[model samples]
Target chain A: MTGSKTTEYVTLVSNDGYEFKLLRSAACLAGTIKKALDPTSGFIETTQNRVDLPTINGVVLEKVCEYLYYNQKHAESRDVSDMDIPPELCLELLIAADYLDV
Target chain B: MSGRRPRGAGIRGPHSALTDFLAANNISAQEIRDSYQQRVRQAEQEAAQTDDNGEGPSNGGAEVEEDLQAESSTMAAERTRKRKRDQDEAIAKIKKGKAAKKVQKKKQKKNSSDDDSDFEDVMDMYKKAKPLPGQLENCELCNKRFTVTPYSKAGPEGGLLCTPCGKEMVKDTKAEAKANKPVVRRGRRKMESNRLDGMTDCGPKTLQQLCIEKLAQHSEDIDELGEMPEGIMNRISEIFSKKRAMNSTTMKLFLQPDMDRVAIHEAAYLETEDYDQIFAICPNVKRLSLRNCCQFKDSNIDYMNEKARALEEIQLLGANLVSNDKWAELFIARGKDLKAFKVEWLDAAFDDEAVEALTTFCPNLERLKLERCKQIGPDSIDAIARLQHLKHLTLRFHDPITREKLTHLIRSIGTNLETLCLEHFLDNTSDPTDDVLATIHTTCTRLSKFRFTENNECTDAGYVNLFSHWSNPPLRYIDINSTRDLDNTNPDGPQESPIGLASAGFLALMTHSGPSLEFLDISSCRHISHETFTLVFDGVKQYPHLVEINLSFCPVVDTHVVAGIFRSCPLVKKVVTFGCFRVEDVRVPQGIVLIGAPRAQDLIEQFGEGSLDL
Candidate 1:
């Protein structure tokens, strides 16, 4: 829980066993992931420094990760450009966005 | 009957203000013109005599020309010096309005001696001594001799400049002007909304608001807002509709095949076919609410009648394009299923017959609202009276109806009503003993929100009777603005019993309903004296539920009354005191807002919620 143990990055594992090692700040952009990995809450994921999201598949999770990084990059800005989204995976990505609360 | 022009008849257009001022001082316009003409003729005669006696002395015309040339040469040198000094003064004047006033006074003194100088300047303007085309002329800026051309531009001081130098000067002036201009950036609408919310901060939006705005910015890029809670979906829909992103493509994502209700808050962008699409998608929907549906047509309703048979409630606003016959047909077809029906801003078609048809068909209807619909009149008053199940009734009409018909309408349906809002019965003959208010007091027992506004007809006694020992539970909202005597001659109305909601009635209203009242607007109830205001909001008696109160145009309300309101109404969030100029020096608490006081701007603490920095 102290500052000494805090890592620069955290791991996110998808339902299909794909792991993404993302910057801690970027990963915390998603509200659900932030709450899960919050140090004060003492969640299991907080100690482990990894979140396993079983409901979201790797394809959707990868898009969410890309969006999290994109959001962090343009957090304190105006007139931000939209991230590219594929037409076919829109519904699935929306489900992932809802789960992540982004 | 003297043959003179009538007063005010001659005023057809704007007359010269200077001419008026001269006429007021007894200096005639005719005399001024005649004297000017005589002076010109005398000067011409003297010049003619000089020409005739040319042999006696030197040539008069040549000598006069020589003297003028010598004066102009001296004037040119003086002008250059004056121009530099004037430019410096102009720059200083631009920085302060006070400096400009001093400069203008100095200019007036100079203008009196330069009367003929102005005339000479005008003459020189028409007869420029600049070199003609094909003649060699010195470039004013570079001091280089060049052939004069028609395309040459005049330099700032006077003489013509070479083409390149002129272009460079023009560019330099434009760039300088652009650089000196102050850039203004404003989020004016955001500021207005924040003011309405009693927020003084000019800071950035909250994180949630920002995220919603960003999501709504690119809503088209989103395919589905996929499976969030109902409240979140509606909130997203609200943001989307406000941003006007609820067109055909985005609308489809909002409606699911299984959802029972489809409420689109802003349907201004939807096409006529989209109305049919509501049924096409959500066929089993029970309640349908579409506002600003300007394109709603008869065929859409027909499609809905066939598809959406289980439709129990419908609210459509600004759907004026639908014919009267379509309204009758819809009521006939699905009237039995309807429990609540609200239609507003329908000026073109929906008439008294529509009400007749609704009452005849819809026996189960409980909530009815018809606001700002033009065509319905006294004819439908009795027809609406037939509905036994009406509870929440709001009728803000723009038409003619005698007190008799209105009294009948209220008496028949008032027993079951919960919220009654009646507006603009202004034309009704004054009732010193208001039969309508009497009926409301006796019959409507369940009312929580009551509004009777813009009436010069009801006497104060009527309101007094209604609230004094009334059977109805305490009302939560009361808005009775513009309910006073409107005689222009008497600023103070009849003093014996007072008129409209005066002291007795207002006190009675507070006594009965102050406990449960959450919102109150007694604006423009001018007859209620300052003593009554202070007595009612006396700081010791607490009205626990009151949140917002408007005392606008109530001129007698002072700082003491405002402070007492803060003490008495602990939950009060906003207190509007516009035109209550006497309300200064009150210290508002941290979360409370005190708005519209003329001199309360600087007095607001930094932590105070209502600080409006002027």
Candidate 2:
């Protein structure tokens, strides 16, 4: 951590008080996250380098964070069948994905 | 670190917080299983109790005796009676519960039916309820956010729109609807007027009453009539004939000088002097068509031969009074400039000598139509076929010309032929054979419009060979209706046994020349199947100019093939499927006119009239 350098990590706080730290490039895979954390926007989330999603819960947020990193890693490749999801959390994950527009 | 598992290893594990909460609340799968087992045990115990009651006093006698030894016999008897009363009360309570459940079910059904009727009313109320004036909605037309009011109108496509855009849309639709309204004709207007008169009398109008009113009105207007348009003039002439009102004055309005063409169908009232007066007035008339010319005598043609010397085309129907020598003289005088000649329903005065004179003199003739001429024979056709410059010829012969003569006729003048319509009279036995088709295919390379009907000798092989590879440009109009093989030699065989223009021949034609075909009438071609139609038109994309198709009597044309036609030919405007019974419940696309099918008609009526591009 140099004093004058900008940070690359973005903090996403869920509604149920779970915070996920992700790289800015990985977090920008989601369109809503990218908009909220845009540096040129005058939103408080942009200034604080953090986004608070009041609609998504902790479990869905964790899954979404995992998907963001996974998507970024395999963005150049065609296959993404390695990503696994539990059946019980599928409905909630879909709702979160819709809200995030990913 | 023992609690930490590998990534993605907890896919089926207790991953979600909802699952965790459910587990903590003792709502696990095992708990549900235990509750289901408990319910089964209770049901089984009730069934056993019912069985014991069914066995009655015989099974309970041993137990009752055992109880009597411990107590007095009368006390035991009273206890047994009390137990029996309790069992009857329990059974009655179960029956009452079942009846209550049935009533509740019936009430639910009734409530649903009521909701079905009230649903439309509720929707109406919702539509009538307007939002507050300050509420904002996006304009459906411009997509711009604007403040909505109670008076805001709906857009053409059914969404709330701003006031200015709404007004513009309404004006546009009003103009369009006005433009699409049909122009009423004079005949219909007269009928409507007669209907209104009947309505004023407060009674239903019979056909006789309407005709009487029409005639009474016509007589009052005949005296004061002024100059009218040509269409109205023709309509007046037709009405005069129908009402038996044609006289010298009405006949004189038809003789206009410098008229280039004249078609007079009501020439029965005209005497030979009137004919001479018409010939003198309109000498420059190049085309003259006369029907019901019973009063036209042989001398009238001699008079016309000298007066109307510029006549290039003549159509005479029922003009038997004109002698053959007069017709020959007229052809001899004006045949150099004659281009079209048609004679129909002539019993006499149009015989083999007149036909020979016509062929000998009319070297520049382009069109000739001879129908129902009983005296003309194969020799006259052979003479008529000598004109090499003929481009359009329609021959509907009452006398059966031999196949050899027909073949020779086609081969002689088919080089420059553009439209050839050959229809045999139903009474004629001789049919043009496949050799005639072969001759046409080989010689008539410039043909564009062809119609061959009522010919039973042509077959699918001839059609296949003719359309396999044509040397001319793609044909724009083709009508080969009812040219089937009528000799059903095998009466017990299938109906669709291959006939003229079967699936193979039709597909060959479509694949070879379908791009430029604009109007095709393949009605009554019964041998074409649904599968072949789909296969030929499924993904073929060349028919961009096709506008009208008539598959009226084709039995195998189902809905799927119709849909395929709609999909493949994007510019198709009219489809006639009159007797195709398999085509039901068709959803005709917008802007395409569908003529038959009751369900398709209902759909078109429900969604306004379609626009025909032709």
Candidate 3:
């Protein structure tokens, strides 16, 4: 956080108090985060530089964070057939995506 | 990079991120799995223990064990019988449920009929007590809560709706009502081929048909063909012509000796003698329009000239048998009294000499239209320009004339011209210049209608200049379709690159004279962009009088611009979009006629067969 060489990151806390530090660009992929962190909106999340998702648990939040990073990496690439999602977390991941409007 | 785990590693190894995350959070997946398995095994063991207790009594004492076993066996049999009775009762319950559903449906039907009668009674009450503003109600369509305002309108089914849903309901009901209208059949009469001789072999003839046949059979009893309405007379003549029943005797029904106006649309079967008989009967005919009069020969024309001397207007189409000299003689005989004369599709007759004779003899001619006349040249136009009383002139030339001759004609007939329509169908290289437009703008101050189609030489500068400061009264109709500027020098460029009227000229026309325009056709003027279209028709300046518009072949017009036109022009009743391929999803207002929009079939189909004239 001190030097320009270090990457800037934002902490997203889940309902069970699990914190996942993600890059700002990847976190902005979620529509909820984009609206909360909008500069003109003057939201508490924008001033505090942290967001708390009360509805999502730690396990589902972890999967959502990983998907956001994966989507950011393959945003423009057309060939993304190698990206795999576990069958067990499919239902939970869908619920989280709907909550975040991702 | 260090914080990021490799892809698919979270599902594989002991040190997977998911496992680490679960471990750090004090929640283990193995614990949950083992607990679930243990719960399932406990439930299974409890079920097995119950089965063993039911089957075995050896753990009790020997004497009591035998008696207990007997009692248990009898009790088990009784329980089995009870289970069978419960199964039967459940089946009866299901059948009863189905019958109850049928009874409920019958009751609902009765209630609906009662509601219909109640609704009629409520209509009188609703008329007395209309809903007031500021009342909260649930929208009938979406069930959303809304407060009724003064602007809220009632839905079609007597339900209340929010503002947005109310508008949609109105649109849907209008579309449904329009789609339900019975279509009127037109074109090419439907003749009954089987009942030609009024002898129906299978069924009895209709009362009307029987009456008509009896009247025709007893022709001697009918002494006079009594006075009938003109429309019915036309229908009777058309029926007679279609049935091949119009012989010399039936023709006498139409040819009354005292008739002043007569029009025969289908006279192809009328021979030369029949036409001579028409002239012999109707001597004082003032207005006569004959279509498909192929048997009208020189002798018939001579007879018409001698008998119908009071004729003021005559319209003849497909009268090609009358020779050019005979037409000239006819004009020379009665052209002075003729105020309006129209002839079309004369293949070999009515040439430049006849035009000279028309201009020379018909000094009081006010309306003259000669369409598809190939032999008329620049000299004929020069002769036509000399008529002082010519108010309406329409010339569709099959041969090209020089631009100088057109300019000379416009300049000569400047002040008195009210309606001028000039269409060129030849592949002529000569284009009308800006000077000709300027001459028209300055001279034709009284012009109310002007149509100049297929002149691919007029430029944007000329149109812009003509509309910039118009001194004439607002034109009621203006059609300049296909008047593009095709740059011959750079033919390989884009097709719409050099258009005659661009966005600037169109904007100028709208700002200056759009208020009074009732009919405007700018089809194939491809240089106007959607931005300019939206800007001009953005509900800022309303075109209250515009009724019909044709925007065909304009590539830039899309659905948004069409919606803007609907918003601005309140009186627009007819919109023709033939080749505007981008314009889809149009919302046609109620009572407005839309034509040739292929992609807007959802909206257009609401208007039944008679609504489209394509």
The parts of candidate 2 lying over 4 Å away from their true place are A1-102, B1-254, B265-273, B292-294, B425-433, B487-497, B536-542, B598-614
Native A-B interface contacts kept, per candidate: 0.02, 0.00, 0.00
Compare the candidates by lDDT and give the number of the best one.
1
Over B1-614, each residue of candidate 3 has an lDDT whose tens digit, in order, gives: 12224467766455878878865654546545644565556556655775778854345334544564566556545655675567555765565456555655665666776757556544544442333456555677788878778877676566677999988878888999979988645322222222122222222222223324444444334444566545545555665665566666777787777888777766777778888888788998888877778888899899898888999999988888888899889889886898999988888778899999999998999998988876777788899889889999998987777777778888888789999898863335554467667878888888889887777666677788788887878789988887775566763224443446778778877876787899888898877778889898786678989988889988888777776777778887667777888888665554555566767755543222222211
Better of 2 and 3 by lDDT: 3
RMSD of 1: 29.6
DockQ of each: 0.04, 0.01, 0.02
> Which of the numbered candidates is closest to the native, going by highest DockQ?
1
Residue B585 Cα positional deviation in candidate 2, in Å, after optimal superposition: 2.4
Compared with the true structure, what per-residue lDDT tens digits does model 2 show for residues A16-89?
A: 99999999998887888888877676577777778899988999899888877767776543212335555455
lDDT of 3: 0.71
Q: Across residues A23-57, which tens digit of lDDT does each residue of candidate 3 receive?
A: 98989888898787776777777766688999889
Candidate 2 lDDT tens digits, B140-191: 8899877778878887667788988978878899999979989545363443
What's the lDDT for candidate 2?
0.70
Residues B1-614 of candidate 1: C-alpha lDDT, one tens digit per residue? 01122357865555599867854554545544544565456546757777687744347655665565566556544654675567555654454344344444465567758767566545644654566555556799998877678988889988898878878888899999979988544464543455566753233333334445566778888766667556657767788898899887888877888888888888999998888888998999998889999999989988988999889998999999899999999999887778889999999999999989998999888988888999999888788888899888888888867888888999999989998988886455444458889999988999999999988778888999999999999999999988998889997899987778999999999999999999999999999998888899988888999999999999999988988888888888888888988988776664666777876666633224443221
Chain A of candidate 2 gets a TM-score of 0.90
- Candidate 1 clashing pairs, residues 3+ apart or interchain: none
Steric clashes per prediction: 0, 0, 0
Error of 3 at B230 (Å): 4.9
Instruction: After the best TM-score superposition of candidate 3, give how far the Cα of residue B163 lies from its true spot, in angstroms.
Output: 60
- Model 1 residue B238 CA deviation in Å: 2.8
What TM-scores do the predictions have? Answer: 0.61, 0.51, 0.51
